[model samples]
Target chain A: MVLVALLTGGLFLPQWAMFIVTIAFAKALVALGLMILLRAGLISFGQALYYCLGAYAAGALGRFLGIADIFVQMLAGAAAAGIAAFILGFLLAKYRGIFFGLLSLALSMILYGLLVKNETLGSTDGFNILPSTLFGTRPGPAWVRYAVLASAAVVSLGLALVVHRYLRTPLGRLAPAIKDNEIRVEYMGASARYAVHVIYVVAAVLAGVGGALAATTVGHIDPDMAFWTTSGEFIFITILAGTGSVVAPFAGALIYEIIHTTAYDLSPNTWQLSLGAALLIIIVFLPQGLWSLVSKMSTRYARHP
Target chain B: MRKVLVALAVAAAMPAAHAQSVKIGVVTFLSGPAAAPFGVPAKNSAEFVVEQLNNGQAPAPYSKKGFGGAPLEIVLLDEAGSTTTQVTEFRNLVQRQNVDLIIGYVSSGNCLAIAPVAEELKKLTNFFDCGTPRIFEDASYEYVFRTSPTATMDSVGAALYVKDAKPGVKSIAGLNQNYAWGQDSWGDFEATMKVLVPSLDVKTSQMPKLFAGQYNAEISALLSAKPDVIHSSFWDGDLEAFILQAGPRGLMKQSLTILTTGETAMHKLGKQIPDGTVLGARGPFGPYAPNNQYNKWFHGGFVAKYKDEPNYASYQMAQAFLGVKAAWEKAQDANGGKRPSNEQVAAALKGSTFEGPGGTVKMSIGKGHQAVMETAYGVTKLQGGKLTVTNVKRYPAEKVNPPEGVKSADWIKGGFKAQ
Candidate 1:
């Protein structure tokens, strides 16, 4: 029902509204990946590495190779990120806690350093990519944004459903158990490192997809995508969204975008303060995040009525 | 009863007829590293110009109330985020705020990202600052216009100044920020120097990251090279910090340092900048601004209101507003004294020459979407505790900027042939 509403919202909503929703959904994909890590008691502070890789892959394709198909660009983004994640997962899965986070951050910054120095890709200023086309045809100027929005809605919902099913599987249920006691999970005849590696790659692939979509929607990419602060924003959204359900990240991302946009519009200079205050309020009042509110209300009404 | 009803109708109709206001979205860095040096001054200039324009207090040619008799309404937005955030904000400015026109961008990255969106939206947009030449050279736009000269002029003008001031200069080194603007500026200056002075040798070039405050290692490297000249395109806090750090080390005293965007730091860090340092304000701005009635009006009002001389950023902002006003009034006049559409205003602005606070700005490049103006560079001299520029050399717009259909780099590579 929510998916239908969002897809329909593309038709009637103003350009700005559609843009905000599209970006929110794209970032939500990254947060959704972060949700899996948070549930497993892992924090990867450098998810932006995959995000940047994905965006650059898509961007480079459009810029260098002249491939404008949205699906092809996204596939390239996902494939590139997935490969990088698969290789890096070996080293990353051996660690947990802050070590894992810091290592990820270092890796992302390494990419940032390399990108900032590469002059052909326009260096720090980056470069613009051609707008995406649907298969072989370009959408009308008025409908182009709607096309991107529709793509985001369909892809996000499809991935969310898949992740929801994954959460129901035995392997998926092992995340909380692994978080509680890794040794115990190893004693149960499953390799904790193996599960971690799989999950890490999955998370990276999701972030990659999100980055590509964002780049396509924004029509520009830069090394800032891999900066530590960008990764911090994903973590912020993940915590705010909670690991309650597959859909919670989307809800949280949408709410965060709305709050950020409204606050920025209201006070350009002090918007950061307002955003900090909102985060503080959320952390203080809703420890389990905004998702907990929905779950709490649902349970309370069921029990009392 | 009939007379009273007619009077009431006329009163209501009068308000309806005169209530029109042109909403313009003004974006700048309200909170960030760029806010203080470039963004705030531009914002201040916008506010000052709008207030004056609204009251018809501006000098001749811009004395019309507001834009073509329509009061100006500005919706300000911050330009502190990544390109994606800037693009989203640009859309919001047009679609959500319903701004009739848009102006402001201090970062070349933000400007490049916003240009296509402005074209896509068909909104009359003006870029007050942001010095990259790619915006016009890479693509063409009807609705997007840049009111300030590109960074090429600054580099070329600096090169000309160096050639004229230090004829026998030998080796050169660079300490530029590692970005497109810095890289492009250094490249142009080096290319121009090669064309003008064939014997100049390159010693070493250092590129620290943007906003990288500490330059100890880079400064040491530059000092060791002991080149005859050093060129840097540092701006904002980085520029101030470089002067502070390099002055005590005698780097500036040893080498004839050329800061392409150095005029901004002159007022605040005058004592720190060593004499003989060559500086440019990207164009004829700040100390190099011409002595014209419009400039006097703008400079006087800016100093009176802010209690400080307006920098190049402020001048550029005023130039953008004046350009808009000129175009709007021209379109209105052409439209038989009625409110003009954005297309009409854009048409009037294309290939038009107008007076800026700095001097005459010609929309002669980027197919008339980009501006070209005369640029000046000078040697800084601290005389009696007051920092003043001396031996200023002015380079005409045609002499410095690439002609309409040529890219800046390519044009420089081809020996800067006259069009």
Candidate 2:
């Protein structure tokens, strides 16, 4: 029902609202990936690496190969990010805590540095990707936002459902076990490192799809996509969403977008202060994040009525 | 029945009354590293300009009421975020806020991203301060207009100044930020210098990331190169920070430095910038602004409000608003003194000439969608505890800017023909 509502939102929402929702959904994919890592007691501060790679992949595909199809661009983005993650996971899987976080941050910054120096891709002022095409055809200008929004809804919903089902499996349930005690998981004959590597790849693929969608929706990509602050924002959303359910990331992302847009509009000079205050309030009052509030409300209603 | 009829009549009359004002969405960096030097001044100028235009207090030729009799309504937004965030905010301004026109954007990246989106929305958008030439050279848009000369003018004029002022200069080195604006500026300056002085020795070029305030390594490299001239296009906090860091180390004294966007830092870091350092305002702006009635009005108004002198950023912002007003009034005139459509306003803005605080701005390039203006460069000198430019040289728009249909790099490489 929630997915249906989001899918149909394009039919009635204003263009600005639709744009906000589209970007929120795209970013929610990244935050969703972060949630998986958070569940496994690992935090990758360089999620923006895959995010930026995906965006650049989509942008390069249109710029170089002339493939304007959104699906093809998204697939290329996912594949590129997945492959990179699979390779880096070997070294990253061995680390834990701040070491893992700092290493991830270093990796993303490396990409940022390279992209900033690579003048061919427009240096820091990265190039714009052409307006996306649905399959082989182009949507008219008026309908383009709607098309992108619909695409984001469908892709995010499908991925969210798959992730939800995956989380129910024994392998997926091993995340908390690894987080609690890697030694115990190893004693049970399960390779914790292998699970970490697989989860990292999955998370990277999700972030890649998000980045591609964002590039197509925003119609531009830049090295800042891989900047530490971009990754920081993803982590912020993950913390705000919590590890309660698959749907929390989307809600958290949507609310974050709304707060950001409204705060900026209301107080352009002190919007960052507003965002900081919001985060502080959330951390203090809802330690388990916004999803806890939703679950609490349902339980209260059941007990009372 | 009588009360219902009266209510319906009042409702019908509300829109006509509300149409008396024109809403303009103004985007600038009100926060972030750019705010203190560039964005806040532009925002203040917009506020002041809107107030003056509404009251018809501006100089002659711009004495008409706001937008040809409709009061100017400003919806200000902050331009502090990534390109994607900017794109989203732009849509909000146009579609949600329902602004009639949009003005502002200081970052070349934001301008480049927003140009296509503006065209896609078919909204009249004027770029006030971004200096990228690629906006027009890369793509064309009927609805998009930039009322400032590209970075080409700043770099080319700096090169001309170097040749004229420092005639015996042998070698040149550069320390530009690693970005499109810095890269393009250095490229133009180098190409122009090469064309003017064929035997000029080119030394090492250092490119640090934008806002990489620490410049010890870059400064050491530049000092080792020992070039006769060192060119930089640093602006805002980075520009001031460079002066502060490089001055104590005697780097400025070691080489003749040319700062393309130096006017913005002169007042703020007057004591830090050494004498004989060459400065350009991106165009005939700030200290180099022409002493005309338009300038007198703008400068006087800005100083009175801000309690300080207007800089290049302030000048550019006021210039953009003036250009929009001129085009708007012209369109209204053509429409029999009635509110004109965005298409009509865009038509009037195309290839139009307007008097600004910086003197004359001609929308003469990018098929009349881009602006061209003369640029000036000068050496800094301390006077009465304030920094002022001496040995000022003004380069005509034709001399500095590339001819129509020619890219800036290509024009410089082709020996700057048709000047």
Mark the regions of model 2 whose C-alpha exceeds 4 Å error after superposition.
A1-3, A300-305, B1-17
DockQ of each: 0.77, 0.67
True contacts kept of each: 0.68, 0.68
Model 1 interface root-mean-square deviation = 1.0
What is candidate 2's CA lDDT for residue A158? Answer: 91
Which lDDT tens digits does candidate 2 get at residues B136-163? Answer: 9988899999999998888889999999
* Model 1 residue B201 CA deviation in Å: 1.4
Candidate 1 — which pairs collide? none
Query: Best DockQ goes to which candidate?
Result: 1
Task: Report the C-alpha lDDT of model 2 over A188-288, residue by residue, as the tens digit.
Answer: 99999999998899999999999999999898899999999999999999899887999999999999999888887787778889988988899899999
DockQ of 1: 0.77
